[model samples]
Target: MIPDATLAALFAAAVAARENAHAPYSRFHVGAAVLSESGAIHAGCNVEVASFPEGWCAETTAIGKLVSAGEKSIRAVVVVAEGDRLTTPCGGCRQRLAEFAAPDTPVHVGGPDGIRRVFTVGELLPASFELEEQP
Candidate 1:
């Protein structure tokens, strides 16, 4: 298990990114922060559009940044929602996260004290989605 400090930092980064969320349609803001094995932190917010499908998930954005930064894998992630609810990564984002993060990787959902949640990729996404696979 990773230290509490690491999860705390990731949550803080997620909150910062949430401020950048652009959800004009649903008005649901979201943020995500991904941690790489090399200790680089990448943050992203949901970018929505009228076309809908054109918008990107916060997790995907963070993953894109991580990839651009030459990260081969993700160690952990934190997600935050605008409201004080137990918001988690959407299904698509879960699949994407499973691509890079191990099943045991940590994922923290930030919200009001009573609404916060935390789960692993396996817990959120379950099993049997193809990402990069072992030979």
Candidate 2:
């Protein structure tokens, strides 16, 4: 579990990022924030393209920022979306996050009403597919 203050900050960042989302098609703006191992917070908003399936999720964008900043590990992550209901990361984003976050990393979901739920990466994606050396 992460500190309450840190989690609050993550949630705030995600909410703020959602304002910049370019989701004209779906009109479902989403934002995500990643807390790196070094305690740096990175944020991103969803970007939608005219071509379906070419859109980028907020979580993926935030993870990209984390990697661009030279961080290889994520300690925690939060996602926020429009409306009163919380929004969790999609399956693809969950898998992408697994690449940099431990299975026990905290994943917070929130909405305008604030954090609605929290779960570990493993809980969100049980038995995640991972590559291992097969000697």
Candidate 3:
């Protein structure tokens, strides 16, 4: 389990990033923050373009930043969005996260008020596809 303080910090980062989301079409702003194995936190907001299906999810952006920074593993993640129900990562984002985060990695879902739910990567993506490492 992630420490309370660490979770709080991730939540705050995610919330702050959410403010910059560009979702003029869907109007569904979302933010995601990832805690890398190096103890660095990276945050990103959803970016939607005029062309449908060309936009990227918050998790995708966060993962991209993590990889660009030379981080290969994720310790934890938090996603924040405002809605009646908790907004967890979509299917594609879940797969994207699983590429870097272990099955036991914590994935927290939050709303405007506060965190609403916490799930493991395995829980969200059971039987996920994994590539075999080459020696």
Best by TM-score: 3
Q: Per-residue lDDT for 87 in model 3?
A: 94
Span of 10 residues, lowest total lDDT, candidate 3: 1-10
Model 1: ten consecutive residues of lowest lDDT:
109-118
User: Once superposed on the true structure, which residue ranges of model 3 sit more than 4 Å away at CA?
Assistant: none
How many clashing residue pairs, candidate 1? Answer: 0
Per-residue lDDT tens digits for candidate 1, residues 28-85, read 8888999999988899999999997899988889999999999979898888886655
Candidate rank order under TM-score: 3, 2, 1
Ten contiguous residues with the weakest lDDT in model 2:
80-89
lDDT of 2: 0.91
Each candidate's TM vs. the true structure? 0.89, 0.94, 0.97
Clashes of 3: 0
List where candidate 2 sits over 4 angstroms from the true fold. Answer: 133-135
TM-score of candidate 2 relative to the true fold: 0.94
